[model samples]
Target: MVSFTASAQYGKQKKADTLFNKFSFVKAAEVYKELIENKYNEDYAVRRLADCYALLRDVKNAAKYYKKAVKQDNVPIEYYYNYAQALRGVEDYKGSREWMRRYKDSGGVTSTKNFGKDGNFITSIFNAKQQYFLSKVNFNSKLSDFGAYEHNGKVYFASTRDEGVSVKRLYGWNEQPFLDVYVTEKGSKDPVDHKAKLKGDVNSIYHDGPVAITKDGTTMYFTRNDFFKNVQEKDKKGINNIKIYRATLKDSVWTDVEDLPINNSEYTTQHPALSSDGKKLYFASDRPGGFGGSDIYAVDINEDGSLGTPENLGDVINTPGAEGMPFINNEGTLFFSSDGHVGLGMLDIFATVADKDNKIIDVINLGVPVNSSKDDFSFFMGEDGLTGYIASNRSGGMGDDDIYAYNRVPLLNVEGVVTDAINKKPIANAIITLLDGNNRQIAYMETDEEGYYEINIDRDVDYNITASQKKYEDDSESFTTKNIETKVTTITKNLELNPVQDVVILAELNTIYFDFDKHNIRPDAALELDKIVNLMLNEYPGMVIRIESHTDSRGDLTYNDKLSIDRANSTYEYLISKGIDPARITEHQGFGERRLTNGCDGSVNCEESNHQLNRRTEFIVIKMK
Candidate 1:
């Protein structure tokens, strides 16, 4: 016969475990509380109940039970680790660190290494709980046999289920059906099941499945081959070279299927991407001189629509394994799918920064939830950068390679304008920037000709806007915005220009015209001198102003210099006689037979009007105070 106390304890323990197994963690915790209330197997029940609460994300109760379990002794290292992780999840970083240290001190080790071989710490500080997966876009069987790309509120993909003139052929032994390019809007209730076929020479006898549409949805680049036309020929090696072709949209129809020059007679080139500006072309090539099997290459698009010679993107982007399907986001971040790279799945999506010089840097593997053990490739990121679409063959998908959507945290959008303060005139090409309080540049852009600029900024940060130009003092303004909101602000400011000072005021000696070179101011010259007196009284009422005179290149340099000085002195005396203070006027210097506005060698180009530019009297603002 069972002892009464032992049987009662056994019954309570069984009830707690049963509730825990059902995922009713709160109920299980209550049962554990009742057992502990009676002091029946208190330690075991408490620890088990802590694990149940932790599974339910009740970290506070989990920590309490874990402490109780440790006090009772025989508490495993996993219990402490779980408790520490729970504390960290609750943002108790300091306490969590202490517990983790204690757990390690108790002869415990983390199962995975914290640092990568590159010596960089790999743990994500961002809470994974804050991330979410959006709804999966299910493509029915009629539309499932295609690859899709979204642009301008439309999804462009390729399909060939008796919707075209030519019968499509299966490319490989896996017997995947060949396809032709098609397009449909985003919010169609019917899964594009019976949409009209895309018009153009988009389909051929061979496979033309994979496609990439430019941001404007006007241009398209797709992969196809001429193999089927020459199938009866003997030599087979040259027939399988799949090449990419470009098409233009004209009059609501795609015309001019032109083969890109980057395609060579020796190897295959496919999966082309045109930059947003349509100036750079990125594509995958299996030609020789590559780093590995297939490498990404880029070519400059000339203004006349011809392509320059292609250059390989080096080993940073390409690896020993094939690095294909290169897609560049609007912010110039590069996303591609590779099988040779180490990742969570067979073929995973990787991201890297594409620098201005077209070099790849800081390659990162997109971790779990985006990548599974199955093949996941053909990724496309939206213009917003926070939403992404990827094609996958993972189980539970709607088709062989279904599309999945996920939320991506976007780089913030910082936009503003620059204008003249007084006139309110729009200043074009004005450089504007947003900097942190520490003066680090967070975002920057130059205003367009219309005096407008928009830049994407990271969220939850403060920044100062700095605007500057030639002949203007730098302007710095500060602003902040809530996360995920488009901020519109304006900066209207005036640039006060400093006047030039210490400039010489020059009078033409020819205007003093004496009787065949006399050294005195003539009557007509005295009238011009009176004009100077009036100008001095009006502009520089109290300042000391200097007068200087100059002669043409005809007279002797020394004699004409003295004549010029006498004429200047005569003019200064007249100004002093006109009730102007003698202290406010000064003696003049002369430059004779030199510093002529025109070259002295007498050419038709040296006209008198040209000399007028040099003959003018100039005034400088000396001291206002």
Candidate 2:
């Protein structure tokens, strides 16, 4: 091996390679940039600089350097991948896929369909309906600012604002001041003027910020540079990695700053987001055995206040690229930023919907205004869940990275429990549906074991929440979210469905009146039969019913039998036409005036009312499944 230790240029080259290997892209780019500006290592420096920008999702800069970074032969396959992604970020689809194809041919995945020109990635996200209306916050400065959170009546964020004495000491990487923790009163008309940096204990001379507060607001776990207590330690490359620190609030003062157990100096561990119960702390780390350069991890916040071993989120959420900046909303959604996922070619925000048991139900990207073809990260939402802030280096920002506030029109959700009216006990497995003002079904879901169901509704619309179950009468309630003016964000509705009647015999049926021995069903008869039809179809969706028709003894037995059969067939056909499944009809037959009530079997004269009773048609539950 040649010894290049005597050369200054070789020493810098080795340092840049070390930084890049450790995933310190921001500083690695700076080191590579110096090598290129001085012409010390133009060929190697240009390619490595572009690689650093690509990994950090600075796509525009990555593309710029990538134009000059190509080598004729023996180039690493990842260079093709980075150039392809950077090209896509600038909307140059044709150029992107050319390099993407090269990546596929060079020991990458054989299928280039995902990043190809014909890919549906952009079209899918662009065609989606906008979920939120974003407004750039007023407090963004001409430096990097991001990761805003709310507690009590104040908003806390990480910013490179000039208030900190460390502001004068710019970082060697981005040329911005070291990140410091800052706070301001929430919902202020001009929060920038009120923004103040945290005290010495919290905001140190090095990078500090992006904190996670507990539910009670008494404790917080934050991220800061590993230079604490004047004991600055570095790796083989002499670069100090990040660490997670815990601080407690006492009498409105944050103190007792201490290092968390999960921190590792060999790698970066930062971006702490505490669970709603403060029992688990979710964070982003570059630790080994991860699916990506960085992956979101979670550790138990033990009952005694010590930390447990970190667990990776899993393969579903982490890819082989960088993923960081994790935040868990009050409802247990894990929101994080990732360049690994298929998005608009930059860092895009995504979320994992979780149930109370912490099982992930779905993963979704927060598309469009919340995501652009630029580096967007550090997403945070407020207590209301509608108002929030994000960080982006997208076009027309006030700084290298600017903070943007997004206020979504509260997605009006209505949820409740279904229970028994008599015993007031939960009704599980009940089918619940929601309808709009026009009576169109908007959504439907089944009640869980605890009889809980939730659904979102459109704003300024009236809704009818209905619950149904076998052997139960359907119950419904009407609610309107129109003109609420944010006074009511969610509606709680409980439904108590009543049980249907146990059974009905033939005598209970309405009169089967016909005009002068005619067998056709009259309008009055149709109305009467409808009640039975509803009972069979709705009350017992799986039950089959037998339809029986009777006739008066005034006609011959053969003719009467034929006429009675006609009446039964006509009634059965009507039920079928009304959406009652034909397979649900067990029998449709006529008795032909046999065994008539009141002994009116043609041997004696009977009153009209008594004859009407004999002419009646009825049903009996024959089968159930």
Best by TM-score, which number? Answer: 2
Each prediction's TM-score versus the true structure: 0.46, 0.68
Question: For model 1, how does the per-residue alpha-carbon lDDT over 106-137 read when each residue is reduced to its tens digit?
Answer: 88653222212212212332312233254576
lDDT of all predictions, in order shown?
0.62, 0.78
lDDT for predicted candidate 1 compared with the true structure: 0.62
Query: In angstroms, what RMSD does candidate 2 have relative to the true structure?
Result: 10.1
Worst 10 residues of 2 by lDDT: 109-118
Give the clash total for candidate 1.
5
**TM-score, model 2 to reference:** 0.68
lDDT of 2: 0.78
Q: Which segments of model 1 are wrong by more than 4 Å?
A: 1-132, 140-147, 159-168, 193-196, 214-217, 227-239, 354-359, 411-625
Per-residue lDDT tens digits of candidate 2, residues 201-271? Answer: 77787899898888887888889999777687776666789999988888787888998889878889999
